[model samples]
Target: MVAADRNAGGIRGQKAVFVGPHQLLRPLGEGGMGQVYLARSPGLRLLAVKVIRPEYAEDPQFQRRFQQEVEAARRVTGFHTPPVVDAEPRGRRPWMATAYLPAPALGEVILRFGTFSEAGVRALGAALAEALAAIHAAGVVHRDLKPGNVLIARDGPRVIDFGISRAFDATHLTRTGMVCGTPGYIAPECIVSASVTSAAADVFSLGCLLVYALTGRTPFGSGEPAQINRRVVYEEPDLSGVPGTLRPLVASCLDKDPARRSTATTLLGALAPVDPGALLSPGLLAELDARERQAEADLAAPQADPPALPVRTWQSLSRRGLFGLGAGLGAGAAAAVGVPLLLTRRTRPTGSAATVGKPVDAWGVDAAGTGSPPAGPEPLWSKPITGMTVDHQLSLLGATPVWWNEGMGAVGYDGTTGRQAWSREDAQFFQVQNDLIYGTSLDFAGLVWLNDKAESHRSPLVVPAAQRDEAAMSLRVFGADSRTVVLARETSLTGGGIVAGADLGSGAVLWQQEITENLAVSLARHQDSMLSGSGSSMGLVADGRCYFEDSGVIHAVDLRTGASRWQATGVTSAGVPSRLLRTGGLLLVVHGLAVVALDPATGQQRWAAPATPQPIFGCALGAGRLLLSGAMGTAYCLDVTTGRGSWHTTVGVTTAADRGADYQAPSAGEGFFGVPLPSRPSGVAVLDAADGAIRWVVNSASDEGRWTTAAKGGTLYCASATTLRAFRAGGA
Candidate 1:
């Protein structure tokens, strides 16, 4: 799929890879020094290649600009900036390539998707501001900052065509009288004099961009160039549609005086908390994916040869498919390092590399509950059901334990007495937050929630249209915080996940991010068969952040808006989730054989965990200590802050684990952790929280085909085909 740049400038009748030599072009600029011609690039071009004719390639001035743009681009690298890939300035036909972005220009998206929500515009502004900051920080000025120059990628906005502008170079721009930037979005100062353009000029353009983003019209109304320039230099911006909250910032960014404009850094600080990833509509996101697929399809069109030493480039495969965005930025923005999460082998290990026979501190957890219980588990209550029993489909909503009864739906029973609380056949419960039980309709197309009183609320989903027959798609809840309940839609378990957050009170989609990375892995790669009690396959939620491991990276997503707060990439996967867990005051990433602790706020590795005797499989956090279990019935406990081993122990049960047994994530809660014995799918080994002591083991009745368990609120719940039993630290 990845072929080198075959000779460009293909036949006139066939698809043109690059504008063939001798092709006629409109004279964009004519001056005393040189003449500039306009050349159009294909939408799906893998690299934003700027090709020049042999005559221009030898020009000292042209070569200088090409080399300068390449150097400037290489200096600027960030989530918002596309990287310079390959360049051949001195070649027969000089050419340079930047990561080709697949998404549409800002103007195109706005035209197709309509004006962004108020919050979305803010996010756009913040992201653009960050891009500007990176560009300026690299000492490069983006002379042209406009809607068309910015690509609204799945993850964030990408400032494109920054330094590399062959046909539209600064020297040519000034002579053409079109100014240094686009007419409507250009700063007044730039129109007045191109030579005076600076970073502040970009900020002015940013303001214009935001106004256009929010209102779908330029701050300076479009008209003849002279007229637009006159309005930009003399008139007050048309801010009627801009949000009142953002008007001030927009106004400041558009300040006529460059010195008076808000710096990108200041804008970043002011808008840092905004979750830009959460504001796009499902249609817009779907279109982004469609654009990528379309670009790939464009590549399939037969290649035509174009003579003249073609700019040689390289391409490799990646999760995104043949283009392999992870290596270099793919068609562009999604190719940024943020796209694919890779496991890093380097680590900032805690204490010292663990010594096998050495003694360390014991691990402990404190799931605050009714009270501290006895040392060992005690049977609480057992109830029999005549029908609808699916082992392990259990969750504790407050003082009630809810189980999924196949076909019939959710069945909830009181935690203390085992009396049936309320059964909802209409929906299946998945998460509980803010004293409310969150669930989805049997088809997973609608959102359903109920307060502790059993009062339920329902709202339809924007995606997964049931009427349209979208059975290939399934929505998974990332849990709800006080403000937003996030759900991610995916075709399958692996990649291309789009997470959207809905308002807690209104059930309206507030925000979402196109995380085309490995969604299933993020959700549960570590634990394949056994899912953590947290509801999803393999993710953790704490302090309003959802942490999950995808490929080799751990991403911390803000629950309020579904924006990624931080990404801890390169974490070599040691074990199953909560692989990306926030516990004991630190974020722990498990990959390979050890867990690494990172600052939850920054994702900076605090330390790598002490080693365990077996490959780590299961993990849980309580108080400030972590508990990780391994096969051969072995487990390790350690202080979260110090990474000091508290105690390591191996309980009974040396039976071989099931295939990919290490992939099954263990369930833990209250004060213990449990893993299936696998002798059958019905037996479980329970471990004490204070120490790695085996609290008790349960074997399913032969009649029960399969059994599953859930540990929550200091109680271990074992469910079979016809009965459910609750166990605690002591006899209830």
Candidate 2:
């Protein structure tokens, strides 16, 4: 038996000290994008760093795209892929780091241990299925899901290397003429059309990956790349040597037609019947068992050299829990990584983690069915949050975001629920024309609405502060004089801010000026304008003029004339525009690295200052203080006029850990709760928003499950997968 270090490739000869603060160890491999170095933090936290290759740095286009991709990748929160800890995409070398796993890729495992026995194959299938489920749920497609991408962790299998994934509804980079994926791993649709929906393409790749895992060969075997392409497009998979239990399922995955292929959900259900042990032939199973035992016996044996890639220690690598006897189709995926790391030649039970308690009620109804559903009662009307739904048509198309009339007000639903408890609706007052509700708290002051009607109200419209779409805002208030109504003008798509006014009883005009277009997402306002987001071309201003951005390219626009701003032809690109803010006679713009104070009167740049995680507005001017949040897990207190920082604090994703964590500021109670990551259990943490400081940490064993919280009567109600817990001020 050989030690893992035998193949270290003269690692000692290279300078070993790490370059990052986390101090990852020296790398084992280098690639086109970056080098993969192993390292550890002071507390023995292992990590992998991908340092960008120098040649790629010279290409500005690739650099921008890489930065954007890294940001998008980090936003994906789940257990399947490695999480980003620190990134320096703009640094001299540009690198990103993630938690490291002391495991081998499926490719390495197969090479070292020979081919997988039947049981090992079954477990591998299951793990892959679970990983895909999570990845897809995040609206991302792994484009590449092959053996080399699967990592076998000690406790389970993990999916990694998302360098080429596609986010749903995002931009595409591969030119029309170029091929985008590994040959064998490419789906038939991708190979044939080069343009398939993200979800469909991924399902196709899953099938191809399963074939390789089960038989140690691609469904379309070794051949010229061109020949393989032809075979993949025309041929039926040859499943000659695959274990019987896995043959049928693997066959379905290989369907030439993408629609005919089984969905991940369906595949997971299909994997249930196969016993992990049955996938292997009897003789091979016996041989593997013997080899595992022998390998263990030899762990202590002295060796002259690290064995080549293919060597196996028969004694030490037992095939016990590794048997995966009952693992279903998902088992193969799980087994592919889970078994290798988990079994450790030792026996342990293997099954999905106890369904995290009676499976979170898919429907909001409780055991009694009478408890309040999170969204509140059957709505007088219903509207979905902009980014909440999986369906994009709700926003891209002219779908009406429903507004409900509740008492004197209206609210928005959290999507599917009907109960009034969790639902949030907007209260209206057209009388207060052009006012919309837009704040983080439930206080009346936080609920004002901006009605864009150009006329005065029928009555004196008086209401709290808020920000909502025209439809929702109009329904909330009543205007008297049709002429004096102050409503947001439906000029064109991407129009500037929501202009405010009082509606005159007459149907004529009222006071109106251009509202800023800094942070608007409404299609009704910004329609005619192409979201001018190309390289150096920031998105269009609300009024359809050119705009500019840092991490995002701002579209060139004439500030004085609301005319279309022309840019150089062929300079096509897109980017996010930071909203403009007014501070102390200085017009402030929040770019990627710092807040630049511009002279609003002349459009001149004034002062630029740095900030942490990039400031995203959280609340309108509360007194003189501005509230904001960042990509990092914290919220900030900034001066509304000076563009100065006041305080910062960490907000839990939610009241409960199981509910998942969110960085949005919590409505101040005894303190605010951070939302938890969905994959993690529910717990609560309180912090000072004035200065990023944790006040308390409470573990919520939520019965509602999935870390979620609700506050009422001065107590924070929390729930997890199994238990429900509560916390309050003074730990009451």
Candidate 3:
């Protein structure tokens, strides 16, 4: 469907218009050889129609190349690539029409969201690899497979801009000396000798794409084309921030020798175990859905024909014959046109007059209702924590609040006085467990542990001398008991390196188990890779057992002896697990649609909850209840022991553009649960945990107040972009 031209002011300068049966709405983009437009068919289907520049339209050479692009693109048929709808290569203004997808380019997503996580990168790699495989299977080579050509959509990443792509049998159109492709992503052979460009070159480009996805920067530094081209041909790629799990494969793809690079099929096989759906954030998916709905609505509206010329036809090139053309066309086109640029505009600040008044006293109620609720909502001291720059939501380090700043490590503040308690420089706080805070610091070259007093201890994470010096590493600490701490450590070089039990006091490793197989191996053995889990909670320690997931199996290990106690399967088949919680003698692991509760001692399944329509974002266990917040804004409370639903409620305002996109897991206190309201007049909804009834909504004046909320000690703490505010029961 064609997207409405919201910015169709006027064509700057152009006389002849209209291509075949499509009427041009607005110039989407213009390049030297062609111009793309947002156009509509007679039936009003929206399409992105690329029409060769008038000058090039008349060139027999350019005509053949344009025809080749249409044919090559038509050969790809899947959700990963935009489908060619119609084409008139022999017309007066040769043009090709493809499905119009209203989404940002991968480059734009990277620019806006910064770098993706390891899981996200893996998902992206898998999708692009599958796309490349399809392109190759059709005997076509996408010579220009860079970030700009990849569109991020709700369903998956879509490959576009096949202007330079050609079928294997088509003739090469470029002269010997001309090099093609975006410099930073160009393969070595393309820079050194463009004549030998092959499918491997596309593989090299995929490596560049993966690097850009993991680190906001390209492998080759951006600068003068000559310089970047030189680096692409000679220098080792800069994969500084690329996760270790993917570094080896990415490095192989970027190999200087084309023979060393993996084929699209091989790469797809390697990443097949990764779940692509897990890569997309709810917010982005919601935005994509909104765009699609808007586009559908726009196309459904009546469309008026803009100033246009009559459609002309030529009979020389038939659609079927174009697909059979030999030798393929060279990779050259006018700069890519018709690409959309998204801009966000914020509304003026709303006044505080609409803010919700002080709420009624609702505190001091225990789990069994031994204490009464507060008399009324009372104002607590609003003390600003100093040294906070680029507002980050505060997490609890016990009762003390802690936060991290880029380049500033972690800082903690006293909960009562708001006085600075301690600070750890050069380390970013990851999680808090018991009295120890775990974080990573490149300055220390490994994971570090900080005590409540801010004393630091480094873990013994040694690297082999033969390995690269700057190998990227990540740690997921499950929990720490009296003597042992259970954690999982992964290096990019090896997929899931090790799950170990470490000494709680000295940070010394006690026992470790190596995971030798990659995701591909795991999938081949089990038919599904059980990589899914909560992105936030990896595993949990309870009953002298260390619980964690590996390749779809939940494993229980003896904390003292490091021996495998038992293992249970069927938690998740793909995607990383969402969360692992231990409560009420049950070890719960939420992965994608499945929520399994297991006996902590025997690793036996107690009860498995049925899948939900949307993924569960957060879950809290308290007051004999387990509360879960879904991506679609649904809140569910289940009986903690049986995993049966006790109550379900739709808690917040959701729209097509942002359905449950802003829903965060509710924070549970003794008697109340707090959830952030992301809609207009942003606020926190305080609900009765027992019945799912709204007790009060602490509303803010502006939408900016919808940041993050945390509840503790009958107090609700709200962190906005600009400030942090705390609220308590009235007259507390």
Best by TM-score: 3
Ten contiguous residues with the weakest lDDT in model 2: 323-332
TM-score (C-alpha, index-matched) for candidate 2: 0.36
Question: Between candidates 1 and 2, which one is better according to lDDT?
Answer: 1
lDDT tens digits, residue span 114-183, model 3: 5688888888988898888888777677888876688888778888876444421122333213465666
Question: Judged by lDDT relative to the true structure, which candidate is superior, 2 or 3?
Answer: 3
**Model 1 misses residue 335 by how many Å?**
30
Error of 2 at 361 (Å): 69
Instruction: Compute each candidate's TM-score over C-alphas.
Output: 0.45, 0.36, 0.52
- Number of the top lDDT candidate: 3
> What residue runs in model 1 are displaced by over 4 Å at the alpha carbon?
1-378, 389-391, 405-408, 430-436, 442-445, 451-453, 464-473, 491-494, 521-551, 557-564, 572-578, 611-613, 652-671, 700-707, 712-714, 730-732
In candidate 1, what are the lDDT values of residues 491-519, reduced to their tens digit? 32213456677775666777766654445
TM-score of 1: 0.45
Output the lDDT of residue 26, model 1: 18
Q: What global local distance difference test value does model 3 have?
A: 0.57
Model 2 Cα shift for residue 701 (angstroms)? 70
